[model samples]
Target: MTLKQALNRTREIFVANNIADARLESELLLRHTLNISQTQLYIDINQELSPEQEKAFWHLVKRRLNGEPTVYITGHREFYGLDFYVDPNVLIPRPESELLVEKALKLAQHQPGVTIAEIGTGCGAIAISLALNLPQAKIYATDISAPALKVARANCQKHGVLNRVRLLLGDMLDSLPQPVDLIVANLPYVKESELLAQFPVSSEPRLALNGGPDGLERIRQLCRQLNGKLRPEGYLLLEIGQGQETAVTTFLSNLLPSAEIEVTPDLSGIDRVVSLHLT
Candidate 1:
């Protein structure tokens, strides 16, 4: 089949299954299968796909049809303009989480040699991105799941930031070697009730999604642990779920009543990042 024909068929299949962004997904799968660039694909749109390429493309399509995420199938994702290896072991990085990276970057820029810790550093996207952007920053990244850390470590190495990023295996800040100037986390915030009612993606790791009854358990735990882990005048950046602005803000206020707090919304106008500055 020709490239155009394959994409058309794949998109039709995805659309029939109610997958959003079918055209984009189909194109990505086709590019991965053909090992071709977007420009190359367009240039070769009318060219016939080799048998091997066609077979591989259809295999990936089948996986997508089975409800697997494209990032898992492609084994990579782009975050902060950098590509990171990803799989089912780690939660796929989303564009919304970039806000956390943005906030961290802005904070680190003003503090030379800023020490930072990333809680639940799945795929090491945030930590590595910060390390790349802030070359002088020392970053400690921790993940409860060793498998997720493995992915994160690989990404750190791939991005040439392994030397700057210390990967730790522990929950929250328990494994950090010392307090840091900043702490950033994209912890699991999906409520158990939400998981029970309707899980977002079954293929994703539940440990990376479940956040107790109200989706704020892990956030609360981190807040309680920030007392000594974060340096005086340090900052904490957190990526939260939609509509969680008020709850997370209130919880942090109660924990550190005098700390300065701000909520930054994503492009969709959802409260996606919560920034807290210690007194």
Candidate 2:
């Protein structure tokens, strides 16, 4: 079949299979299969798809049909305009996460040579992006899973900010050598009951998504420990799951009553991030 015809059929299959963003997903799969850019696709729309290419495309289609995340299939994802390596070992980076980075940037502004810590540094997307954007800042990133840390480290190198990021393998900041000027995290916040209904939890790592019964277990623990780890008057920024802002804010308030805690919305207008000052 011609390349255009093959892509048409793949798009139909993806849409019929209930794949979200069907056209974009099909184009990505085809681009991976053909080792070409999306722009190139239109230029070569009439090119014939060899039997081997067709077979490989079908394999990827099957995986997507089974609800696997496309980033895992592509083995990479772009964050803050930089590509990062990703695997099942790490949670896929989301658009909502950019809010956390923005908050961190604003908080760190004018604080040259500032130090920051990022808990659950999945794929090192947040830490690397922060390091890239705030060149004068030094970032410490931690993850409980070693495999996830491995992916995060590789991503730091890919972004050429490894020199600015120190990677730690431990739960939260348990293994850090010292406290930082700012602490940022996008840790697991989905309650077990909620996760039971949504997400391929069984497919992804449990440690990355399960935040106990109330979905604020990790956030609570982190908040309690943050006072000791954040410098006096330091800042804390977090990316929360949907419907989690109020709970997270309360948790922060109880931990530091004098601290200023605020919930910020993402570009989509969802309460997606929380910021706290260690007053």
Candidate 3:
């Protein structure tokens, strides 16, 4: 089968199953299967696929039809224009989390020696992205799951930030050796009650998505720990779920009554990122 034929077939199958972004996912899976770049894929769009290649491509499509995420099949995800190694071990990095990186970059600007901590670093996409952008900054990437840290460590090395982004094994702020000038987290904000019902996300490690009854459990605990782990006047940027703005902001406000709290929306205008500037 030609590359174009394979791509079309995959897209058709994905669309029939009601998968969102069917065309994009089809191209991504095809590129991954052939280990080719998008540019090359298009350049050879009419090239015939070897029997083995065609079989391998169909196998991945089958996995996707069975509810496995395409990123897991590809074992790669892109965040903030950087490629990350991902698997079932860590939550796949989401584009919405890029807001956290952007805000942190601006906050850490001109402060070459600034210290930053990323709670629940998952695949280390956020920490490594910041480290690469702010080479002089001290960055700590922490996760409670040992296996998740392994994935983060690999990405740190892949991005050549091994010497810069420290991978620590601990929960939230507990692993930070010292208070940081900036704390950014995309902690699991999915309500525990809703976790099991969320597909694709349900395939991710429960440790990375469970946030107790209200989906603010982890966010709340991180807020409570800001006293010692966050320096005076430091900034905290958190990615939250829809309808969580009031609860998360109220919690942060009551905890640090004098701090400045702000919520930023994603492209969809959802209240996705909550920012707090400590006084």
Candidate 4:
């Protein structure tokens, strides 16, 4: 069938299934199937698609309709203006999370050559972006799953920062060799009860999202373990879920009430990052 015909049919299917961003989804699927860019799609609107290509496009559409994330289907995502490979093994890099990287970049400006560690590196987007932007910084990244670490390693190489970012396989701070100048984490902070009720858990890895009973389990653990893992004058920049700011900050206060804590919001104005500078 012609590209135009295939695109129209795919749009209909997506709309009928109530898929979000149906038109954009159809365009991306068509682009992937035809191995062309959006501009090329218009140029080749009349070109015909092979049967194999048609089959592949339909498969992707079916997966999307089944609630699978488009990023996972495409095996790629763009974050902080850099492209990274993604899959079911890792949480898709998100725009909101870019704020965390931005905050880190600004903080790194004054502390060049500082050692940094990223807990739950997943696709290594944060660590790699920091290493790329902060050329003098050394970063260590960790993920509990080996598959996730493999993807992160490839991404580190893709960004040409493999030499600066070390990928490890373990949970939290256990994988790090020593306390770092900064500890940046986007670890799971979602509560157990809210996992199924609010977010798209079907396509994401659960271990990467579940934050235990109160959702502060990992963060609390990180705070306690961080004393031994962080430099005396260093700090921790963490990404927290919506409504988690007060809880996390309050918990941190209970641990180190004398510490300076600040909450920074993302572009959407949600309290997304918790910045803790040691006193």
Candidate 5:
């Protein structure tokens, strides 16, 4: 079959199977299979697929049909318009987390030679995006999993931000060598009980999604460590899950009663990010 025919067939199968964005995903899988860009695929739409090419494409389609994420299958995810390398070892970067990057950039933009720390940097999307945007800032990207750091490191090299964004291996703030002017994070905030139901089974690392019995376990632990790690007047921006606004902001209030705490909602109007500014 021709490339266009193969794409049409895969899209139909995906639609029938109830996959969202079936056409887009089908195109992505096809491009990945042929190792070609979208332009090449369309330009060669009428060309017939080699027997081996058709076989390889079908293999990828089967994987997507069985519940593997397209990003994991293709090994690419875009955040802040930048491509990132992701795998099961690291949580796939989501659009909502871009708020953390934006808030961090804003908080750091005015501070000369600002220093920033991104806890749970995962694939290093947030840290790298920040590094590319704010060249004057020095970023520290930390993760508890060495494998996850491996992915982050690759992305840093891909983006050529390895010199600006340092990859650290440790839990939360422990890897931070000194106080930073801005602290940003997209930590795992899904309740441990909800993780299994919310995400595909074994599709992602448990360590990247688990937040204890309640969703705030890891957030709380990080909040406890913020005392000495943040420079005076530093800002903390966090990307949190839904229904976690009140509890998280309250905890921060009690911990630092004088600090100004604000919550920013995502495009859907759900409270998605909580930012704290220290005086």
Candidate 6:
């Protein structure tokens, strides 16, 4: 079959399986299988797929039909405009989390040699992006899962930020050195009961998704640990789940009573990130 025929077939299968963005997903799979650029794919649309290429394409299609994420199938995902390796060991990087990176960069812009700590830095997406953007800043990233830290460390090295991003394997803030100028986290905020219902992807790490009953447990724990870990006048940027602003705000306020707190929404206008300035 030709490239055009294969893409058409793949899209039909994806659509029939109720997959949203079927066409885009099919195109991405085809591109990955063929090891071709988008331009090359378009230019070579009529090129016939060798038997080997067809076999590989169908393999990926089956995985997608089975609900495996495309990023995992592709082994890489783009975050903050940088491509990073991904696998079932870590949660796939979502675009919404980029808001945390944006807020952190803004806070670090004027502060030279700022020290930043990232809690649960899966795949090192946020920390590596910050390291690339804020060249003068020192970054420390921690993940409780050793496998997740391995992926993060690999990504840090891939992005050439390994020297700047210190990877640690421990619970949030527990492994980080004290007195960091800024702390950013995108911890698991999905409530335990909501996990299967909200995110049915079995391939994603449960340790990166379950946040207890109200979905604020991990955030609360991090707040409790922030008192001395964050330097005075430092900032804490957290990416939270929808409808979590009130509870997170209350918790952080109670923990750091004099801290300045604000909520920043994602592109969809959902309350997504909570930014706090320590007193």
Best by TM-score: 6
Question: lDDT tens digits, residues 1-279, model 1?
Answer: 899999999889888999999999999999988788899999999999889888889999998988899989888799999999999999988898998988888888978789999999989999999999898888999999999999998998899988999999997899988989999999999999898566665788999999999999999999899877999999999999989999999989988999999999999999899999998
lDDT of 6 by residue, 19-38 (tens): 98999899889999988888
Clashing pairs in 6: none
TM-score of 3: 0.97
Give one digit per residue, the lDDT tens place, for model 2 in 235-278: 88888888888778876787789999888889888898898887
Can you tell me which runs of candidate 6 are displaced by over 4 Å?
A: none
Q: Model 1: clashing residue pairs?
A: none
lDDT of 3 by residue, 175-265 (tens): 7899999999999888988876874435888888888999999999998888888999899999999899999988888888999999999
Worst 10 contiguous positions by lDDT, candidate 5: 195-204
Cα error, residue 19 of model 3, in Å, equals 1.5
Stretches of candidate 4 exceeding 4 Å from the true structure: none
Model 5 scores a TM of 0.97
Give the alpha-carbon lDDT of every model: 0.91, 0.86, 0.92, 0.87, 0.92, 0.92
| Alpha carbon lDDT at 257, candidate 4 | 79
Give the alpha carbon lDDT tens digit for every residue of 53-109 in model 5.
999999999998888989999999999999999998899888988888888877788
How does residue 185 of candidate 5 score in lDDT?
87
Q: How many clashes show up in model 6?
A: 0
lDDT of 4 by residue, 43-119 (tens): 99998888898889888888888888888888879899998999999988889999988888888877878898999
Candidate 2: stretches off by over 4 Å? 200-202
Off by over 4 Å in 3: none
